[model samples]
Target: MNILLKSSVLCASILLAACNSDDQQQSQTSSQTITESKYYQTKTPYQPQQDLNKYEAIPQGFQPVFTELVARHGSRGLSSIKYDLALYNLWKQAKAENALTPLGEKLGADLESMMKANILLGYGVEGIRQFGYGNETMSGIQEHRGIADRLLQRLPDLFKTASTQSASILVQSSGVDRAVDSAKFFTAELIQQHPQLKANITPMSYTSLASSSVPTVEDGGVDRFKLYFHSLNKEQDLATPLSASQQAIYDASQAYQKFEEDDAELINKLNELAKNTQAEQIAMRVLNPLFKPEFIKKLGTTGYIFSNTGSYTVTAPNGESITEKGKGKNSIASAVDAAAYVYELYSISGGMKTELKGIDFDQYMPLDAAKFYAEFNDANDFYSKGPSFTESKNVTSAIAQGLKQDLFKQVDAIVDKQQSHRAVLRFAHAEIIIPLATSLELHNMMQPLPLRQTYNYSNSAWRGEIVSPMAANLQWDIYQNTQGTTLVKMFYNEKETLFKSSCNYARYSSNSFYYDYLKLKQCYQIQ
Candidate 1:
């Protein structure tokens, strides 16, 4: 059977790394289908994309031997209070001056409630008593917990064998509170759902490749350096481009640096959108409930920015911990800032649907305007992290090198019999996941757009929601036959997916997903 003929083209709702298409008609139709689902609401929060009971079967003789996964942290509240407070401060000004519309009248209380919700996001979630800004919400906890449970279902024999045979399953985290919290929720739920496996679950580290410890990014460890490779945070020294290789990969690369600085295009686009007649009309249409036209007009000329000086942490009497956030210098300046700020809140509110009740941020955000921002944000990310400029080659390729190396390192150990660990689970943020997704089929999703075209919904199939939503993940399960041939299969966001088309499947498997382990390594150009 010709595997290509049987492949069903998935829509944007299910963006998997795909097989090559020789059928131009199919590719054209598939692109049209995916592009239609790509508009608006790009910050889609977590929901499993794959059907649980419909996984493709492995080759008849292959038995699962090892598994590995790298997952983005589950849904979480706003990272900091700056955006919340900035909008709140603006609301205060509107309230004091009687500039609030009837709809806007309800915002003051809603903003306060939103702040409180973030402060308590993960509190009491699976025994976690205290969580604050940038921490997981109950939705987040359940996301990871459910993912772990599903994994057990996917590879029951391997997990069962590990439980009875004393094999290891290593877990690691990026050390940021949200990512670490995700790791905790995942492993805890794994043990809860299948108590027998607790004996084999361990925290992985480089030293002696030990079992039974959860090493954080703060441990000054190489594992963290690999998984948390994105240089997003500079404050706690979490992940930076200070290292020579990272610097070369990120800092010195001009194309990457332009992306780093957003190609200096983000602010201009925001400003342009703010001035557009249709956007202005829609802004008024959506925010009419919140602010008076005169006040909105006055806001058109004002300007301010939020800034953070520093922060600290606090420990509760019972050992619960929360970050003691310092007052950020926050304010809403002009009409543009107000719209952008509300969009920020609106964007975040999507993640808090399970947490915040009784208040809706939607009343302040117009879908058209929200989409304008989402597209720009998506473009920003596309250039910065996703399948970026192929002409430069080094841009996206270099950013994901560390993650690729780590995946190979763990799997190679299993293949070489140098490690007893049956699984390796990594918890990280979306920035890390995006690059990995692109690399999974760099020749496809990462392929450059046609000449003179730029990244946008209609022109590109990549959507942040499909590729790097909260709790996004990629997994690999390896199986071996009695005759000593090992084969591997990949799952993107828990969906069975083919490897790059250049990497053919096992000839004996009737065009199955399984790839011969050694040939698979060669296909990826991994030495």
Candidate 2:
């Protein structure tokens, strides 16, 4: 017979003997069918979108002026510039159109009060020059402009809240033209007092500088100039003998401040209007259709089930039982909604409970006795070859051996999992075992080598094991007088050894042990 064919036949014989039951054959076939059925279904993927412009309430006269100011002061810091510009522009537009609501009026008044306070708090013209336009200015126009850009990008709700009303609508529709005219007039008057200011008052650029390295004129350079004017206005109030042109610039700055503040109020009122509008409600609503039973069944056939108990039993067209098992639960069309609910609950609550209090499994055992018996039989069947056999001592023995091997594999797996644990163990062995073994080997190697035998060789000092070859292991004493030096005394033990011999010149040889001892003692500061 051919070797491969013989081997295949032998393997087939072994497995056939091991699982020779009708039920086992049926179960295996059903599992194979289930595995084959998974390639025929499709599922839709989920996607999420950013929600902007969903707020119900928005301030009036806010968006357009805000946009314009931001356009003018492109490099200004975001939060301050956006808020202040929005406030100022809203106020200016509301006043111009005479469409300011009560809330808009209040917003305008509050902004004016805040601006005056800010100036009194020591942010005047010189202060603006020092910190508003310079490269190092803390609240530079660029910074405020950046704030507005980010607000528009990241906070849509806030944007809508500041742009949803009639006042804002009117401003957005015609605010740009008016703002441009106002800015020109303001700039002209500002230049009269401080000719240097004219150099800095650039027009707002309509094109965005969001992705650019430089600011454009439309990005709110003028608004920043206006802020600088406010600072100048405050300076005029405190200056001694202010010039007529300075006074005019200061007055112009005040007027601009009032207009900006009023525009801010109108913007806030628009936010309220937007909130009450049906548009806002429709924007915020989310729709999700329910899954019908038939649709669920189709999804189920597409691998939507999540759990299995001894496979799925379906009545075939022939009225016979068809059982399926083994493949993992398909999650295609299952309770996706329920799954979402559970996911949200887990997100909110952290995780599921693993332990429950006040439950008695023992008391329920009698009611579950039939299941217990079936489980016992199933377990026995698992351990033995099948129910056809009376017992399976051989199989149990083989299983025990397999378990032992598996346990060793488990230990190896754990060690593989923790690199640090293995490294520490290896380090310990290197530190403890290798050193000890080397020390013993060295000791054995050191012994029996020929040496001068004037010192006592029979004593334990000469015979003792070497703990370490690098340190002192012996001591000696000698006596000396003017006549000569001579051997005096010695001691020997397992811990240490001693020997002494002496010779005389005027002093011992510098290379001799006595000389070395003296030098060592001197170097160590020993007397």
Candidate 3:
């Protein structure tokens, strides 16, 4: 996990350490409380774990010949104006009803400020050069820049030759603004450090770098990734909805409550009615009847489950399009969505650069109380994107296959001298990164979750923070010796990681982390 800097590791002297000792003690005291709270997961900037200096030495005589990375976009602002507007409306209602706690009162202003900041940052704004629904934050820029700086340090020999020879580095992005920005920021730092790269960087876009969750007909009417994600759980509940007990705790403990004692009868009736209704509808009905229609609309018209050969059309990277059998939104009420804008309000208000702008709204939310919502979000991802629910095996496989093909193609091109690019960097979403990791059958990511089993960190090591934290990356550094023996070492989210169990080839005499490239490809039948 050691992020090496140019020419040396970061070294600190005794004076600086001693001077910060008192502050470190105070931080430790506060961090204990924050870390224990599940709300810690909800923090806006879920910082990646830092183990910057943990690198093991390369076997003597192996010089880095090529490197490739696939990384998630950096941390970004909340997507869309709808989230801000939705919460603002709800806050207005609470204020008008005189239900605002002192902490709650502060939330309205915070939301406005946050929305304005995002708007200025080009989120949901038109005519901005890099405008997108989710604009990257300054922290995001730093994240990529830091990654670039570290990579340069890690591959000094490779970069030295590339810079001297003026070899181009190919940068690919999904064409989304945040992703494009991530690529730019990363290379910006790279060129800044190695001036020769300024004339040799080429940024490109590949929109279909990953397949859609839904299936589509391919050329010759064949659908390679025909597994429809939504169809698999047409009626199955994927996310665990907030329980009545959890709701009651939020109402009683938080400074704000959506319902009053006078509404006890209505609450009782809604609770009973919720059993047979969709979770989304139940959530809205419990909070405010008037909000049901708008909230549902916000949920979108897509069906809850997957379908085959019905309506949805998926286009492949080669521009071939096949009509999918089914296309729809998920059926389960995203408990996270049922709760609507509440999650964003809590998440963005703390542990972010914006916190310095005077947002401390997390103080209003009790740590233990927020745990349910946090887990609810985790469950949503676990079932939908991770390995828990139906069709995940195929879904993840399909995702990995395409990226794997692209990866090996690049490797082949480099090895065959068909591609001159010394480095290949790809920027995409978590959907791409998570599944690719699963496809590689990386440890922790491959842990089994029975269809009925819910993902809990205590039981499994697959945490979102570790897998797809904003700016998360999987890096493969290829080294070659005088004999042309190529070896590959991988870093998952910057930590040296091992290959999945089935492909593990580390021998007693070899470094456990470094895998022989030929053996790895053979294990996966890549040829």
Candidate 4:
């Protein structure tokens, strides 16, 4: 029987080689062990033949038993072969490159062992079935069938156990339940029951002789082999029995559909967890730096202070004085002397030639006696009293209206001068103070996060003093339009600050005279 199977395998191999040159070439070059034997040689003896008419039907339970056995072993053999071929090719390529490591060699050996076990188990079942009694002669067949029937009833449970175990292993290995072990188990079982009749089977390495069995050869081997070979040819002509259990196993092994769904769910869950963890980590990293005592200490310190004098001074609250009379004498005394000198100069230039040092300039205006007498006489006679009969009552009313108009014109001029003077003072204040104040505010707001550091404004302020001595002029211009309404405009040098500050207090107003005041209030609120 073995010889006949070997001849059939040889013929099949020849036919396969003729059809697929690439497969034959790959098989030859591959380092994977091939377990070929004379088991397919038709000319060999120890084969038996039986007449189809005399042999009874393979029993009703035969299909299911064959299917269960095949499912349990065939899949295992195929998976092992695949793994061996892949590992062998990898090692062979690595060896060619002089890169074969111990790990690679060990993996190759493991795959080889797996393949050997699969092949032995696959063919061992075939050897027992073909050489030993069939279901018609062996009473053990009924018992085996019963066992198979029981196994069939528990198929769902068996599959669940295998799947769970395989999933656990896959998760530990790669965070994915690839079901590789389950696939192997199924492959081994399948190969066991539906062993390819003419395929070669090489003996596997047994751990102990107690677990190994040797096949016995019968006499009249050559003739018997020919008879068995001819009988296989006739058996091929008959309809093959198909098993439903085999189909079910095949369906279950196609795990791609379930794997894709499960994998998506797992990956999504992991990604959500990772995202939350990263956000928390960033918050902690930022918060940790802020809580450091050094940062808090630095923040608590006072900033730059603006003193009144160009140098320095100590003032007593009770109006006491510390008089140091030298080159660094009292600043207040120096300022008073300067003011007196200016008053004297103004008086001399105003045609008051007489020296009047004792006179109080604020209360009395000392002048030349001749000029004063002339001015007093002119004011008494022409300017002060002579407007008595210049016009009629209605004409005087008209004249009074003209005089009121002239007085208003002079008042407008004074108002313009005062506004211009105030603008200069406001610009000076903004230049000296705004930048320092705004910078400090921004520093405080951003210190809690480590996004910014303490600003070094000492150098910047010093540089500004040298270059402009002003924070850079900030001007608020107010004007009246045709509607007798006031409009306000703010400018920093040439740049407008009106709406650019995004400060509510800095809003433009076209109706109220108090717009600049409102804007300053808004700026205060923003800060």
Candidate 5:
């Protein structure tokens, strides 16, 4: 699907591609292994983890009754012009000194195009600023809309019954603009396919609405306290505040903060790891193709200038743009970091595929470099968000508790017939998804290592791309047979995935993905 920079068409899900015979599923799945370079990069776009047609068969007599999904916001622009602004400054320095090689010279156009595309992402042809600032990119809309289409097909009866019974899809979000925008696009597709759902929903129609930055109580779907439960104040998650009922949630957040502060030993280990992992040799290798040797030496010697935490901009004469007003931080950093600034653009460019096409920064950074950086990036995330500390899951569990419980509570309501909502979808960020994934031990995310062992490509399966790439999500579908037998199944990125190892399905059945709902609670140690 093409994501236009300024003017664009609404490229929804490609359903025809999803329908393949079961025989082709294995070959397609094997072809896209995690070891493949395409899957390794952060810019990897959302691919449904499982082929829609090949998911394990639903047990006979079972029908899907309730569904819930916790999705990371869709692909989006850099939070601000941080990467573009930083790289623009570096590119200008190179141009002034005549340091740019043919490859290096291309950075300017790519950055500009990327910046413009980001400025216009999901903004329509006019490129309005309010929703354009770090908002969902066009590819993101495609990802969610496509998922909605696949979902409607997967559980056609649930939606149909919900419409007939007047059951609303109780929506929830982190309340951040991108996440809320994702929710909007997703629900829009649902209504587009099933007009009857219109009467069952809240009065506000988000799918057709313009992007918004305003915090809203209007969506009724938004419950920041549960969806935006992370304690990390460094980003937009804090935009949504805590209510009195959420006051207990603070105890967990405080505990996390206290652990990070008091654990001088762990801090020392992490610091030690950071000092050695620069991969300066690889940095030089990347820069060699882009700049002259003398220029590299000078950068290595003098360091390069970055900025205080803020976004910068380049306005067109046409007055087209998004958020800018960036304040430059006149700090010094190593030559490698400056090169990484290029890598940053290259990495983020993956999400911009729908908007900015045919731009290749991958030529600048080698696959090994990309892999190194991917791991380097994953290491830090391992501690801050993923299961940190080999011994305990303190960091993530604290923040993720509410989200996990929210899942349990909501699903229980459906099972017990307390609520008629067929699908309870929640939109959140990677922070929420990763923590919840690690806390629940989905994939190999449970492996939090000692600081010395550290997270790496070889040792840890907890990769950012596979774990929570653009539009990362975890969906739970509940099915029941008329005999009162309840079963649950999970789809990670829409692929059929098993729960924690202890969680067992019917051993005799051909399907490995389905699990007894009551046994699932016991496996996770849920009361």
Candidate 6:
């Protein structure tokens, strides 16, 4: 099959499976299909996208040998109190002016309720807990616990061997509380689910495991390309050009803004028409009400640089002309900040029952808005944490190299005779998973966000919702037969995934999601 064709089919399945029946039903009945709109919601606190039962069965008679996973920390509360405080101030101002819609009026009480809940959760007024901001929620704990149980069920032979041979399960995480907490919950549940394995399990927080927070590029550990990846985070003002994919998303966002501002009635009409006729504007319409008009425009302005690429001269206050590179449309911290606040409210509202009487604010803030933010956030990440077609080709390659090093390092340890390890679990933030997926060239991560077209389902392969949602994970299961033929099957966020086409393994066809271990090692140059 053609790479694009195969990619489309696989990506469609993965994305669709990420949604449950309600999401599916909403997609079908709402203004746009998930593909046509292709919005990504960042940290919107959603459940697992893929149904574990629907996962493809392991190929017949392939008993597991070594297994490992790199996972993003599970769903968590907002990273800071800033977003909440910002919106709360806005809500207060809006209330003072009586500018809030009736639904908006309910927000004042809701905000108070959310504040109290956070206080009770030990966040205090500063949103600081013992673990710090953005720590995992209880739901986050259950997420890893559930994932642990499922993995035990999926690879019975691996856990069985660990029990029989007294093999140890090595658990490592970034020192960050969320990542550390994720590793803790996962192992605890793994042990609780299968108590026999507890004696052999050893968990630790390895600074090296948290590559996302500190890529350690300064140590001269990363190669030339890896250095480029490290530079992206600092070269915020670098004139990084956008690809065709990036351009498309930018254009669509522009169009959405244009329609939103100049022809509001038209957008409304289109949305109304979409509701009845399944028109594309329906998704846009659904998302339009989530924000006040001013904030939406602000977000649009902040997001512009990601779509269109170039540098312009800015006149300093001292009347000197300074040629500054355009890192993105908005400053790094401000880009999608509004979306972040909106998502924070969404999560906060989950705890507000009594205070939310007259309004269904969550419905007003549909998944479409989250998807739009997700797309925007992914664009920001594309430069900072993901591979893309940059003016400098080396950016993504650097991070990919770093992650490949970590992957092979773990793989070598797992396969080492002295270790006798059944599993290796490494937990970190979305930063690690995104770049690692790009390095691995799995599914949507393989395609660069284009420069000229909107990154809807049809044009681009990347979908942040499935690729790096909270609790997202990538797993590699090594299997060997009695004849000692070892093979590897990879899974991204629980869905079976194929290696990049360039690294076609001898054991599996291009369409096959499995690969020979030796071929994979050679393809990745995993020494």
All candidates' lDDT scores? 0.63, 0.23, 0.52, 0.22, 0.67, 0.51
- Give lDDT for model 2: 0.23
By lDDT, the best candidate is 5
Model 2 per-residue lDDT tens digits across residues 449-526: 112211111211111111111011111222223333222111111111111112212123422223232332233232
Steric collisions counted per model: 5, 57, 23, 38, 5, 29
For each candidate, give its TM-score against the true structure: 0.79, 0.15, 0.66, 0.15, 0.86, 0.64
Cα displacement (Å) at residue 101, model 1:
2.5
Query: What lDDT is obtained when candidate 3 is compared to the true structure?
Result: 0.52
For model 3, state the Cα shift of residue 26 in Å. Answer: 28
User: Which pairs clash in the backbone of model 1?
Assistant: 103-289, 104-289, 104-290, 203-213, 302-333
Off by over 4 Å in 4: 1-80, 101-110, 116-121, 127-527
**C-alpha positional error of residue 503 in candidate 1 after TM-score superposition, expressed in Å:** 2.9
lDDT of 6 by residue, 215-305 (tens): 2223322222221222232143123555453333334333433433455433332232112222123333432453355533343343321
Q: Tell me, what's the RMSD of every candidate?
A: 8.0, 41.4, 16.3, 55.2, 7.5, 13.4
Candidate 3: segments with Cα more than 4 A from true spot = 1-50, 122-133, 203-340, 349-352, 390-392, 414-419, 506-511
Greater-lDDT candidate between 2 and 6: 6
Which lDDT tens digits does candidate 4 get at residues 1-527?
Answer: 00000000010001111111122322242111111211111101111111223322222221110011100000011211222333233334344554534433444444333333323322233222221111011111222233223332323333333332321111000000111121222223322432331121111110011213221112110111111111112233223342453232223222322322354533342232222222222222322221232322222134211111221112233454322112221121121122222222222211111112232222211222111221222111111111111221111112122212222222233234322111111101211122222222211111111112111111111111111111122223334434333333332222222332234344333322123333443453422
- In angstroms, the error of model 5 at 37 is 2.8
Candidate 1 ranges beyond 4 A from true positions = 1-43, 124-130, 204-214, 217-222, 232-282, 300-331, 449-451, 504-511
